[model samples]
Target chain A: MDVIQIVVIGLIATVLIVVVKTQRPELALLLSVAAGIILFLLVLGKIGSIIDIVRDLADRAGIGSIYLGTILKIIGIAYIAEFGAQICRDAGEGAVATKIEFASKILIMVLAVPIVVAVLDALLKLVP
Target chain B: MEAIRSLVQNLIVIIILAMLLEMFLPAGEMRKYVKMVMGLLIIVAVVQAVGELVRWDYRDEIPPLTEKNNEAELSGIMAAASRITGNQEQKALEQYKSGLSKQVRALVHLHKETPVLEVDVKVQSGRNEPDYGQLKEIILFVAGETSSGKESEGAVKEGVEPVTVQIGSTIETDEHIENRDSPAGAAEADLISMVANFYNLSTEQVKIIYR
Candidate 1:
């Protein structure tokens, strides 16, 4: 698969979605969602090595992986929330999408508390 | 990094294909639910990918089930089973062959004249059936078991190494007693009598067919 191939794919999908939307709006949404999911899965396999690289970098920095783990979780929450929000918006559920975004932000905030506390504690120690 | 790049490329291709396929699917009333499910699936996948990116295999922390599968354990069990069954099968085969050898000892005189070869017994058994009580059926095939062509001593030394044979089981009958004057007929008569006497059954009760 190359740029041209992806462009071809995008062209095909765009045409199909356009044709489907006019005949069946629901099917168009389903098509778009399915495409999004498939794209996500394809990118998933790529992420494993990226994770390895990040872990390697953290190890080099003499940082505990616990904080890095938390950060990863927060990142996941944010990404998922945005994804859900987008899907909801596409499905014409603005309120539901907004709620999803709100929930994701809260979850991410909660997840970051430990890191934030540690950072603050370190700053206070430096001041003292 | 190159692998990841290729993966992303493939993913784009897959997305396009999925779009084409989903476009053709029936737009059911649960469109919102369908979208939610798809989005959730992607999100979970992404989370898993991201978790794996940091090599955070949290699954190792989870407790195993009582009967979780272990490859080494399973292989050992399988090997032990195969060894046991192999021994049992060999034993059963020898027992059957010896039984046939004894029953046809009188027919040794007949083997010299007739096309009668030694009986080969193969027992088909299920996995758990060690004693072979669940043995479905026994196949009896006879091939070049005659030791007449080779040196008699050499034949004894060669031994029976379980070669493939496809012939069916054959039984001698007394119905042709009227033709007992001929050598083949006489051999048949003797065979029927010997087998019937051994099994304590009338010759009429036994059924034998050749393939």
Candidate 2:
């Protein structure tokens, strides 16, 4: 679905949640969380499709499939770390969340080292 | 999976019923354990339900075949890339075939000939400048040329390289000659106009970089 459809559905869901909250606050919270999750799943599907296309293109470009995999894995790590950190903050464990974010960055940097080394190798070979 | 789902659903019902029963029963030490069990059962039930759903969805689907060689897939990928990078795929392919002989002798390391690169045009209006719809037309004109597959490949290998073209007047002030905007009592108004103009981007399309 397009951005407009997603926004309209979100707004409708938010309105339903607000109305439900007035009667059953607990159920309303649950429904709100479910709506957010459903939306997240939809967006995640789009991102996965995009990543697949990028991977295919990178492979065709002779950029190496492994390099694309590394980039995607790095992206996944960053996203998961951010996701965990956000959940921690929502649970009032901001310190733990911050630690998770820090760890994710360090891990990403480590993961990127191989690509960096390969790029350097490519450049050096180009130098004569 | 079906059995697991049924078990989990039953467990949820049991937990809810237990919580309700505890509300009526006497407030004793057992109440705490009952509530704890209720929470554990609920978590277990939800996890099992989700797992069952995933299993059921994938049960009939064939697993993707693993392939080490991706040369054919790579060609399809290049075609998609041509479309994405605004090159005519057919044109690029034709150019690739025609130029293969020339490229083979020139470069021994690179197997495939690189397509002609495209230039990107970025036009920015002044903060107080009026919006011009013509900019969009210009961008489309520059971007739209990738109709043939041959031309597309040619563009990718040896097309006009992409370049950003910026068009706007720089603001000048006594304090700073290279100021982005005119500074005066109109700071807020100027800033708002600048922001609005910035959002009104036109012709951010890719163009071929002709040699």
Candidate 3:
């Protein structure tokens, strides 16, 4: 049911962008970004439910909430960064999109640093 | 055997969760980094599961990440709160001192015979002191008889020196009143007692410096 609504929105946005692109490229870009945000918003509730299920599964398995939280955060950051980069690419700023991706990679690495260290530490402990 | 079975079950659940999360990862450039992190999560889960089986206490080596973050953030919040409280307390004390000085100056103005030039009030500000915020002393600068013309500002500034009456305790003030040889001294003593009584303070605490 929601899929139909999303598809309709995407179709309408595509037609509008095709119609407006020749007149004002900047407005077309804005229209595309707005459409992306609208689509994301429509599915935001579903994302929350999915996250809750993951958290519940993590709890049931006796996995620490911290690990689950970090994984979720990484997923969120990746999603946002990918969205931003795509927007930049759509605006014909490939260099800016690349930079955004680079920043996201670094941020993702920083968030993973502790886990990496923990893994290394555990490995070292097991060796001894 | 039961513990081994449960450990395997936890590992299976963690793997399944990891697979589910991988499905949500953004395609293209970001996918590899997300997948790598996901792989690390699985590794961590496996290591923890093995550690649990052996009773090695893997969690002890690495602290609760969220709790550590929260503790650091909590300390920062507490520091900011204390800093704000100290600044607010200092501001309140300054306002209280200035307000008291204005009240004392106005109270002295009620006396037509002795014109007050200035009033300095000190209050007990020590937070630990039993009499904190209580008035400590009131120093009144009363104009002398020679400059009592009320417009003798220049004369008072240059030549005529105001009399200094240091009032202390109710008994000392009464003694000073008895020993007062000049009419002006007697009037100054009366003015001091009136103020002391008005503020419900001891006459000794109200000191008048005639200028």
Chain A TM-scores for all candidates read 0.89, 0.69, 0.95
lDDT of 1 at B7: 42
DockQ comparisons of all candidates to the true complex: 0.02, 0.01, 0.45
Count of clashes, each model: 2, 41, 5
Residue-wise C-alpha lDDT for candidate 1, range B75-185, written one tens digit per residue: 899999999988987787667756755555444445444343444323334445675522222222223432322211101212334243335774432222244455544
lDDT of 2 at B93: 43
**Candidate 3 DockQ category?**
acceptable
* Cα lDDT over the full model 2: 0.46
Maximum-TM-score candidate: 3
DockQ measured for candidate 2 = 0.01
Candidate 1 chain B: 10-residue stretch with minimal lDDT: B148-157
Better of 1 and 3 by lDDT: 3
Worst 10 residues of 2 chain B by lDDT: B133-142
- In candidate 3, position B180 carries an lDDT of 45
lDDT of 1 at A74: 55
lDDT by residue (tens digit), candidate 2, A36-118: 67777878767766666555544333345565565556556665666667656655678998898778767766766666566
Among all windows of ten consecutive residues in candidate 2 chain A, which has the lowest summed lDDT?
A55-64
lDDT of 3 at A77: 90
lDDT for each residue of candidate 3 in B1-211, tens digit (9 for 90 to 100):
6668888899889888887888898997899999998899788878877776765343445555477788999999999999999899888999999999999888888988778888889899887889988998887876664322222111122244544455674332222223344555566767788888988888778877646
